[model samples]
Target chain A: DTAVSQTPKYLVTQMGNDKSIKCEQNLGHDTMYWYKQDSKKFLKIMFSYNNKELIINETVPNRFSPKSPDKAHLNLHINSLELGDSAVYFCASSPQGHYGYTFGSGTRLTVV
Target chain B: SQQGEEDPQALSIQEGENATMNCSYKTSINNLQWYRQNSGRGLVHLILIRSNEREKHSGRLRVTLDTSKKSSSLLITASRAADTASYFCATERQGAQKLVFGQGTRLTINP
Candidate 1:
């Protein structure tokens, strides 16, 4: 079974369109994270939630919001997507007190 | 800002040869980890070395950490064609819950 799973493996949308990406983890981890990988293959952490509590919030724009209904699911909602929003979004989870993370395949979002 | 920077953005070597990748961080860290990512896939964790540890080995993968210099290195012996992938180094800073990743080094293993 896939430990971490993300929906909408590929997404293409117009500018100003809004969309959401869903992520789920069955590893029973306490912490979940969202990372953005640019075309240059630079990975950056966007947001982090530990047990449904917001713990880490980078300097990302307000257009991007992360919601975690529970410790098992974390979703990202982007409002008025811009051209710079086109990139691969990855979802990951790690157990409490554990440093290793399990990542999902990733969702490629394209804004045209 | 990126916390870690990898050296030799890209490297190509023949199969069975050894490959080495280096990572440098800006601040103190609790632990350093190496991950591998294939084309169109997510990253897979390889090994981790703590700040107090100097070296660690997992199978053919060897990792070394130097806390004084805030740097680390990963060495793979007898690299195979399947070893062609992007390698990234992530550091968990002291008192931080998030892991900051490096730009990544693309390794190509020629058969």
Candidate 2:
């Protein structure tokens, strides 16, 4: 079984449109995170959720929001997307006290 | 902001050669991990060296952590063309649930 899985491997939408990306992890980890990798391949943390509770919210724009219904799922919703939002987004999960992470294949978003 | 920074943003070497990358962090950490990412794919966990550990070996990959210097290094020996990918060093803080990542080092193993 895939440890981590994400939907919409590729997304292409015009500016001002809204979209969502879904992620699920079967690792049974308590902590999950979302990361964005820009064109230069610089990976940065965007948000973190622990057992459906928000843990970390970086200095991302207000248009981006993360929702976690349960410990096994976390989804990202982007509103009023712009060209700057064109990047690869990755979902990762790990145990509460463990540093080992399992990352799902990223979703590449392109804002045209 | 990124907690760790990897040196030699990009490197290229012939197959069967050794590739070494260094990472430096600012603050104290409980553990440090290395990850590899191929183009258009998610990152893959490579090795994890705890703060108390000085060195660890996994297959052809060796990771060394120097907590005194707030730094770590990953050495890939006898690298093959399939080893071409970006390498990142991530640091886990004492009490944080999130791991901060560093700007990766793009390694190209030429055939």
Candidate 3:
């Protein structure tokens, strides 16, 4: 079974369009994260939720919001997506106080 | 800006040859981890070394941590063609829940 899974493996949308990416983890982890990987392959943490509580919020724009209904699910909602939003979004989860993370395959988002 | 920086952004070597990548971080960290990502795939955890530990080994993967220099290195022996992937080093800072990743080193194993 896939420990971490993300929906919409590929997404293509136009500018000013809004979309959401869903992520779920069956590892029973306490912390879940959303990361953005740019064309250069530089990964950046966008948001983090531990047990459904917002813990880490980077300097991402307000257009990008992350909601975690529970510790097992974390979803990212982007409003008015811009051209710069074209990149791969990854979902990951780790157990409490653990240093290693299990990541999903990733969703490639392309904004035309 | 506690991100880790990896050296030799890219490396290419023949199969069965050894490959080494270095990572440098700005602040003290609780632990340092190495991950591998194949083309069009997610990152997979490889090995993790704690600040207090100097060296660790997992199969053919060897990792070393130097807290004084705030640097770490990952060495892979007998690299195979399937080992061709981007290697990233992430550091978990003290009192931080997030892991900061490096720019990554693209390793190409030629058959």
Candidate 4:
């Protein structure tokens, strides 16, 4: 079974629309993170939540927001999506304060 | 940007050959991790080396860390075609809980 899984593996939305991506981990992890991979294949941390507590928030756009319903779930919501927002989004998790992270398969989002 | 940077952005090798990728970071680190990502897929954790540890091995993967130099290396021996993927080095800076990922090095193992 996949340790980390994200829903809506493919998303196609229009500009000015709002979209959300859901993520869940089955590894009993305490820390979950949201990462964005740009067209250049560069991945950057957008947000990180440890045990449902906000821990790390990078210089992400205000339009993007991350919500943690519980320790096993972290979802990302983007408002007024723009073409520049088109990229792959990944969700990862790990045991609290651990060095290794298990990543989800990723969601490919396209804004047209 | 406190991020790890991998060198030789890309490498192509034949099957049964060894692949080596190096990463350098700017500050002191708590641990260094290596991840592999196949095309269009998310990253998979390969190994981790702590600051106090000099080297670590798992199966065909070997990881080396030099705290003084703030650098690390990942070696995959007897690489197969399936080994072709982008390798990234992530450094968890001292007192920093999250990882700072490198630009990554793409390796192509031809069979």
**Residues B1-111, model 1: lDDT tens digits:** 899999979999999999999999999999999999999999999998888899999999999999988899999999999999999999999999989999999999999
Model 2, runs deviating above 4 Å:
none
Worst 10 residues of 1 chain B by lDDT: B43-52
lDDT string for model 3 (B21-63, tens) is 9999999889999999999999999988988999999999999
Better of 3 and 4 by TM-score: 3
For candidate 3, give the docking quality class from DockQ.
high
Q: Highest lDDT among the candidates is held by which one?
A: 1
Q: How many residue pairs clash per model?
A: 0, 0, 0, 0
Please give, for residues A11-83, the per-residue lDDT of candidate 3 as tens digits: 9999999999999999999999999999999999999999999999999999999999989999999999999
lDDT of 1 by residue, A1-112 (tens): 9589999999999999999999999999999999999999999999999999999999999999999999999999999999999999999999898479999999999999
Reference-based TM-score, model 3: 0.99
Q: Please provide TM-scores, in order, for all candidate models, with all chains considered together.
A: 0.99, 0.97, 0.99, 0.97
Positional deviation of A108 in candidate 3, in angstroms? 0.3
Error of 2 at B26 (Å): 0.6
Question: Cα deviation of A90 in candidate 2 (Å)?
Answer: 0.4
Return the DockQ of model 2: 0.81
Q: Pick the candidate with the highest DockQ.
A: 3
With a 3 Å backbone cut-off (N, CA, C), the pairs that clash in candidate 3 are: none
lDDT of 2 by residue, A43-97 (tens): 8899999999998999889899999999999999999999999999999999877
